[model samples]
Target: ASYSVRRVVKKSKRRYGRKLESQFQHGGSRSLWQGLRTITDYRTPSSRMVNADASLADELNARFKAADNHANGASGTNSVHAERAGEVNTFTTSEHDVRRAFKRVNTR
Candidate 1:
């Protein structure tokens, strides 16, 4: 039974290694990244975790509200006023400009 288990494990490892190599060879950079992630068993960390109570949410809300208040205080300069002072309030575009922009883009 132990010999069988070892054989199975060896076979699985060989198969996985082959697959990873193939991914790196023919898959380009994206496939290479995927292969690396697979090798490392990589997973994106969750942005938020489940909470048994609402205290976490309440704390986050309070923090965000405090930050908002601080940003809006008299010591903080309004972005809109700064933009107005820079004299870039309006945006203008033309069909020719659009065509030129599109022409500059690579189709591939």
Candidate 2:
């Protein structure tokens, strides 16, 4: 009786030779450069630059708020989650606004 758990092993060794720009510089992490294209049909202004922090904060806050609402009186964890959710939401929007203002100042 040979019951063996088959496991995937990468026998071929190859170094990943690539130059990666961090989200702060290039405005995106996780090799998702392809997703940077604007959704609008019209071409984006040549001068427009993406602000990574604003984008990140907006995303993080929304998710936290949603999670806290779902916690719903389970225990102290729920209360903590709700409090943190509000904090995250506030921080996200505040940072986003500041980032937007900063970009406007720089671009003009």
C-alpha local distance difference test of each model: 0.78, 0.51
**Model 1 lDDT per residue over 20-101, tens place:** 7887777576877876887679898985665546887799987776676577672455554566796755789999999999
How close is each model in CA RMSD to the real structure? 13.0, 19.7
| Model 2 segments more than 4 A misplaced | 1-51, 73-108
TM-scores of the models, in the given order? 0.35, 0.21
For candidate 1, what is the lDDT?
0.78
Candidate 1 to truth, TM: 0.35
The sequence of per-residue lDDT tens digits that candidate 2 reaches over residues 26-69 is 75564444333332243547754465668778888877766665
